[model samples]
Target: MLFGAGAGMLAGLACGGGSGDDARPAVLAHIGHDVAAPAFATLHERAGALVAALEPLCAGPDATTLAAAQAAWSEERDAWSRVLPFGFGPLPPELNALDFWPVRVDTVETAVAGAPAAADAGYLGGLGVSAKGMPALEYLLWGEDPGAALTAFQSEDGARRCGYARALAVDIEARTDALATAWASEYADALATAGTGSAAYPSLKAGVDEVINKSIDACLTMVKGKLDNPLGNLSGAAEDPSLMESRFSGRTRADLQANLAGVWAVYHGADLDAPAAGISVLVAALDPALDERVRAQYARTVEVLVAVPEPLTEALVADRTAVQLARDELDTFRRLLKLDVASTLGVTLALSDNDGD
Candidate 1:
């Protein structure tokens, strides 16, 4: 769902804390709650603007570099747009790099051989759907015109087995991991190509990954809490009446608005309570294999990239003056990058992980 630039930028502003404070944690500081379906629509418009801006840069950074950038960008942006009806989660950076951006780059570099590109996109799409939860439920639960929309989403009758409402969560949770593995398999050769260390893409990748991990945790922690369903299923509520009220009884348009205020406070460097459901669920599903992959991805970005992203590697070993100059230049580039969408469309993207379940 996309709106005009104002709607999209407003939605972007409604996201995690913006700036002015260096002491604040980027993810925890913002993670806004004021986001709604409209805001969610706004978000996509803004991201689309970003994708449009990145098109030229995506092309100039060499085939392999562009491939990686496009992969991360596509994964993040597609997942965001695809999951609209359900709601939104912050687009963490790492997942964007590993799964989405490469595919995007490949699409530009080699669209004729789309088989390869599709695989990469499919894989990240799978991974992303696996991770989406709250957005799914938010739409499933309250994304309609109070009575009519609510009944339709919740209705379990003919013509509405699963509506556009929790499909994303189902896709991501059940089918994504395998699909992502396949995406990786499809683009093995292209993905294997070494990228020039100069593209600051790796830093962005690291940031995206961190944010995804945190969001995963946040989703897990929701269990038994307001949004909790032990199995983390979007359909869990539709199946069990008690579960729905227990989790969302107190929730409303106003509550989400209030939560956004809390998110703003975080940006301002205020202490905020961690989401009980999100984080807990994520940790529960963590495995040694996934952990290893995450580490390797982190290492690859930090070790190979020129930028100084946190958590991917150690302290910067570059010349201090040169690094400062580079940082300033990058900042300038970032500022030049304004988000604007060609057109805005309203579509209900169901965010669910019930693909298998």
Candidate 2:
């Protein structure tokens, strides 16, 4: 609502709404950059894969047991494979359409309970009850019984049951991966089998298309992860500073600043061309004038995002629900650095758009 201010008015400028005018353009510029099509598309694709990958991490036990079980199940899978007559081995076309979410839950539950991560994992108390229990389950118990009403995934005793469930999930993952690998193999073999754009070109093209489209989806998710996603929905596990020390190590503040730069570049044009300078400016401004309390809150939030194990996806999908809220507040504090969008020719000019937003 107010606008007239200068460096000489710093004291009153900080106290009154005079700063809002300066802030508005900066915020808008940030929004434009943040939500730009290329950035958004890149992140959206990545987040989709990350959500699928990390969702299974907390399941339990370890990778070793899960692998063993999957190996055994593959033998059985062959039986299913042989009975089919379609291209690329015998997997149920109908089941393949069930989508990854179904398979994701199914697989993670299987791996965690079998070994390395946990002893048991289940939904609906493992009662096999399709109703009355929440559709998805995430629970971990340490030497305690959750009682009969709850689906129990016991380590030693329950391992037998949980192991099989875990195995089933691992089997599903393998089945899917196998399909991709087989397609790639065929593509590669065909490349040398014939001349360019020959009889096998169509087959190779199909495989390439499938993989590229899949990658594009990952990129789209990455954009979403950067701009959206939230902290609460990510993991139930509590923060562990020791783990943080192990993973990030040394200059925590610097690391945090780098993260800000990455996020900033997407929407704020925080100098992708000059990352260090952008991060330095952001950190300097953030530390002194911004509310320390709020800064600390945000700092912790970023910490969680970094630890997420998903690949090609930003670990921030959990925050998808709260992104609007964050953006609304962030709109107040957004800042930008001005730079020339120079033409390839030697001509240089100052555009009025130097909002320094």
Candidate 3:
């Protein structure tokens, strides 16, 4: 799971034997242009929508408005989760600013109390990770009782919370825009031109390998961090939903679902926007049976996740068996990913820049 240069089975996979080498450029292009670019673009758009939705809620705090804002946050958060697994090039520095979880509730409380100006991205960005990202917003918008939060927003201190929330949303919007612009203008080329003496990635395979590893890491994170860590999948351990991502918003289940969706996108080399010639095509060409197995397992894993109840933190205690079942399913998915996918692609996994993440 550690993010270092990938070796192991992928290094042993035979390479340079067929048209596989020739397919690298097309695959890289698909990843940079078709896959990554659209995710960022959509993220940027969704972040903007989130800000717009927040504006209404801030101006008039109520249950209906709060619900609308929460829905918007989920939309933006889903877009962001899809893009997070592609953590390379121009992404790492911005990730924490986007969604640092297990958010410091105290820091967010302080920031809300201070109610700094909302127009300043610099000021917003300088705030602690917990105070400026999605998790912080989750706390403000949906804490334990969203009704109470709504009431508070309507109270005298409502302005402070609303103002702070606006500032955070503005910061998110700006960061997403910058990311989209960077990928479109520069980072995409860095990935597409990898291996042509590119400093970031010595070879196209290295670029592809980095993404593949990130996808694998993303899956592991879902299993260990999102699911098992909170569910206490280990024997005789009590579950702890408090450790779950987006617990304040009851979004833990949705986050893993989004994570799985991201992994699928990375494997197939496509996203919500368009389909691209991806590693799946190459793998299918190389080994149809392995490709089919991976596809089936990936689909099944997502299904298992979808079948798990929402507010996964609660599901962990109420129906721990379901959580364990999902964990087992993810374990299978991870093996096929870390072992079969890497071997078929003839690319080794490496440490992501956010390695050990």
Candidate 1, residue 155: CA error in Å?
52
Order of the predicted models by lDDT, top scorer first: 3, 2, 1
Task: Give each model's whole-structure lDDT.
Answer: 0.28, 0.30, 0.77
lDDT tens string, model 2, 62-95? 5543333323332233222221111212223423
Candidate 2: segments with Cα more than 4 A from true spot:
1-99, 102-151, 155-157, 173-177, 190-214, 224-357
- lDDT by residue (tens digit), candidate 3, 1-357: 413332322332335322333666677778888888988999999989989998889888888888988898989888888885788778899888787888787888877766564535666655677777888888888877647678878988787788888788888888899999999998888888877766788776677788778878887787777777777664347787778888888878787787788777767878535543777766765567988998788778878888888878778889888888888898788878778878777767775332232
The model with the greatest TM-score is 3
Superposed Cα RMSD, model 3: 5.5
> Candidate 1 lDDT, tens digit per residue, 1-357?
445654444333223222333111233213222222223344344344434433333233333433343343333334333222221222233233322211122232122222222233353253333223333223323222344333442344311212222233233333334333332332222212212131221332222233343322322222222222322244443222223221222232122223222222222222326432211122222222433443343233223223533211111122333323333332222111111000010111223242121
Q: Candidate 2 vs candidate 3: which has greater TM-score?
A: 3
Score candidate 1 by TM-score against the native.
0.20
> Could you say which candidate leads in lDDT?
3
Overall local distance difference test of candidate 3: 0.77
For lDDT, candidate 1 versus 3, the one ahead is 3
